[model samples]
Target: MRRRRFVAAVLAGAGGTAALPNTAGSAAARPDSPARHATGHWQPRAPLPVGRGEVGTAALAGRLFVVGGTVQEGEASPLWASTAVHSYDPRRDRWSVHAPLPKPLTHVGVAASGGRLYAFGGFTDAVHLNPQPDAYAYDPRQDHWHRLPDMPTALGSIAVAAVHGRLHLIGGRDSHRIVTPHGSPVSLGFGTVSAHHVYEPGTDTYRQAPPLPGEARDHAGTAVLASRIHVVGGRVEDVGDNLTRHDVFDTRTQRWLRAAPLPAARSAGAAVVMNGCVIYAGGECRPGSSTDTFDDVTLYDPHLDRWKNLTALPGSRHGFGAAHLNGQAYFAGGSPTCGGGTSTDTFTLSLHH
Candidate 1:
């Protein structure tokens, strides 16, 4: 099925919301602003063996890992969840396959801590349906994944980050349980959630944290710096209802603070902390006939509490993977346009310069 048709099918059951306009008062420098743009250059890297999108990406023990995601056979093909796991070695400039997820999934939340890779809730079916609460931890030494405790709430498109040796699972969306006329519990209806949970690997326990402030959302860009977790733009209730809200959580005081909003509203963008700044790249907006993907690369300076534009991505894309490894930021896979097309393209930008 085409991307538009698939989205329409899901929306018919999930319902829709009024699209929010991008904030004009964001602290981010405008496109034609006189502010100086950050200097950086993107270079091509080895491509993935298969094209995919909505991948969970993280850096572990000097290697970058791309986990479960949506894969397309062709432009006219229907999308499906993948269980494949691939890792890239910056030193070797090559990609290697590893033990796959126990079940196919997409839009998974992933993070690396304590020398191990952890994956959280994600969608088990296509078009963001059937959210799961399953969790797993990967041991790189043995190239194996061990099932962990399920999250308190089942969801997909969640933003996850590790802080002080614990995994913080933030905003996402979940299927709304509604019994059908046939007595089936499988409903495509869904809603965004502000649920937040902290998982402790040592005790294998989870504690409820403060819910995200403002509206519930999914596919928000996230980064951790100085014991604070920054949550950027995301979709409010539907993919097309994107937001420019930026919220920061200070772990020390256990409080939430507001930060500069993104210059443009985006969801499913790749975000990573590099060189003391939060770098967010490529996201999607306005699905369907006027579908659009963002190519703008922007950086947030925590010290200045402001954002500035960096060099734009080579092309528009979303649902890709990004991680900062050895002074360079690596991005891989994702749909080149809005909706379902996938790409094998991978690239890197050095932070040393």
Candidate 2:
């Protein structure tokens, strides 16, 4: 009896695999099959309250926190900048709403450091243009939000991560205007940016890092492992007005290195580190197609410097979010298609082999 209790406790703390109640409609992670690499199969988890895309998510104290997104369907494009923060307690198989964000913002990127949550660069007040550089920090312990110094450049659709006790902000979109040597009716073509920014929490200051090899915005995925940061798969440049390429940046050396291109060029995807592999999942491919989100999942081994096509995601979606917890990757919410709206599905992929 004692041994059984200990095992149950261990599983519960490790994401409550066995404690997951057997319910007809509930999603549960399935044991690995022989054909499928022992990476556990995706189990359905609690769905988000609403379908959304361009959302932000971070992990704190072993709990997953997701916030900010948009619901643009029909004539009403409800800007979802709600301060409503949701906390998922896998141990209890439940989600509880914490204090809302100080302000509602969407298309923002979120990261966690020093036991606090920080959000930066998102759209607010119906401005889909460029995101405001405004920043906010949330204290789960105090159930409150506090403002932080704004970013030097206003940006949205950026990738953020906490590395070496500092917050690293990678490539993002900013307003660009053409300045031709001589004005022409057609001016020059638009040029995207690959600006990389870094923030120091202790000093509350921001600085410019190395630039990305290519200009990319939206749909990019990032991963930090073994003290190195990997930025992969997003739009490359205007491939007829869209860019889908892959690039990597080494924080230790402060330099950017090109990696093998993604099997498919996509945007708005999510990435996480598992078993020494960086996994990039979901997002829209190409343009002019409404909601062209894919259910594809790809894994890159930094040691081998190679990529493998993993099992496809059960459901297709993009603009969703992903995080790694106890060897499993949780992909939740976002739009099912490109131009369409968002989704509320929460799927978990167990990676064993």
Report the number of the highest-TM-score candidate: 1
- Evaluate all candidate structures by whole-model CA lDDT and list the values in order: 0.80, 0.65
Q: Which residue runs of candidate 2 sit more than 4 Å off their true CA positions?
A: 1-40, 71-77, 125-127, 176-192, 236-244, 286-288
lDDT per residue for candidate 2 within 1-353, as digits (tens), equals: 00000000001011111111122221223232221243446788887765556778887877778877775444565555555577676666567777887767776888888999888887663324445788888898888888889998777767887888888887665635333333332222222346677888888899987666544454478788766777777653222333345566657766566666677767678888777668888777444454356788887755445567777887777777887776677777777666336676787787656
TM per candidate comes to 0.85, 0.79
In model 2, state the lDDT of residue 183.
38
**How much RMSD separates candidate 2 from the native structure?**
14.1
* Candidate 1 per-residue C-alpha lDDT over 103-197 given as tens digits, one digit per residue, 9 for 90 to 100: 88999999999999999999987567889999999999999999998899999989999999999998888867422324533334357788788
Instruction: Predict model 1's lDDT versus the native.
Output: 0.80
Model 2: residue 332 alpha-carbon error in angstroms: 1.3
For candidate 2, give the lDDT. 0.65
lDDT of 1 at 41: 85
